[model samples]
Target: MSLAVTFAAIPYRRTGVVEMSDVGQVILCTLLLLAIAVAALVVLKRKGWLARWLGGSAILDQAPAIKRIAQTRLSRSTVVHLIEVTGRRMVVVESKSHIRMLPQDDMESHDPNL
Candidate 1:
């Protein structure tokens, strides 16, 4: 009996690793993008570009009717206020989720629990 052996051929090429210049380019691009975004934010905050875009003017056209008389802070973001509008006084409650207005006749500021 006779046995024959043969080796299969392999076609492959090894490539070089990434160069330092390529890494530097990537870092430079990232820094440039971050700088541009920071600059845009600074410009928006300082120049009030967004306010101008939303139709805000530097001058007041007329006086407001709602006047704040007094305020009591209930919590960090919650407040109760006494306000007068058009000679009618009322109580207003403000919170992160809701704003409430109570009728003038229903509110008693002298009450401690109020």
Candidate 2:
């Protein structure tokens, strides 16, 4: 019996190395830097370094109830009306200004007059 030897061709993949544009490289580098910065910030926050550095607690503390009450004591619309009627608004703004009336429904709950 005679054995025949056969040679099989192997396919090789050629990788094309493409050069990136200057702008694309800059953007990519910037994004990588930003990612690194964000990662560092997250690490600092996790270790409570950020809070200590800022002179605050790591956990978000609720604002004092009295402070909230004081902040929301007067509504913006109400204060605006008071200012307009009392003529303090013009003095405060330091100019002759025409007050544009906003629709009541458009006003935000936390809108400030001053």
Candidate 3:
């Protein structure tokens, strides 16, 4: 009787190097940094420092250019808005399809109460 020997090939796998808790810690740290960055931006924007740093106008500090004095809805799809900008008052007509500013002289002739 002859005895035969055979060797089986096995693949090596890496294990135990990284734990689940370590992965969880990394994710938590990333989320925390993101949240902190967002909070800082909110604080800067609310205090108007962000705009100044970016060399843009501080919208919160400036007076509004257009002010709505009055508005009247003529119909379901049409409305008239009396607006003022830089001391000049004008009537704006808005419909479903278009918006237009009425001429200054025409508005006086059309509406005596204006």
> Who wins the lDDT comparison?
3
Between the candidate structures 2 and 3, which one is better when assessed by lDDT?
A: 3
Model 2, range 41-107, lDDT digits (tens) per residue?
A: 9999999889878978734564332211111213333323312322212211111344444433444
Per-prediction TM-score: 0.41, 0.33, 0.66
TM-score of 2: 0.33
lDDT of 2 at 41: 99
Window of ten residues with lowest summed lDDT in model 1:
54-63
Q: Give me the candidate number with maximum TM-score.
A: 3
Stretches of candidate 3 exceeding 4 Å from the true structure: 1-21, 58-60, 109-114
lDDT of 1 at 5: 75
Where model 2 places Cα greater than 4 Å from the true spot, the runs are 1-20, 57-114
Error of 3 at 42 (Å): 1.6
Alpha-carbon lDDT, every model: 0.83, 0.52, 0.88
lDDT of 1: 0.83
* Candidate closer to the true structure by TM-score (higher is better), 2 or 3: 3
Q: What residue pairs are clashing in model 3?
A: none
The CA lDDT at 103 in model 2 is 34
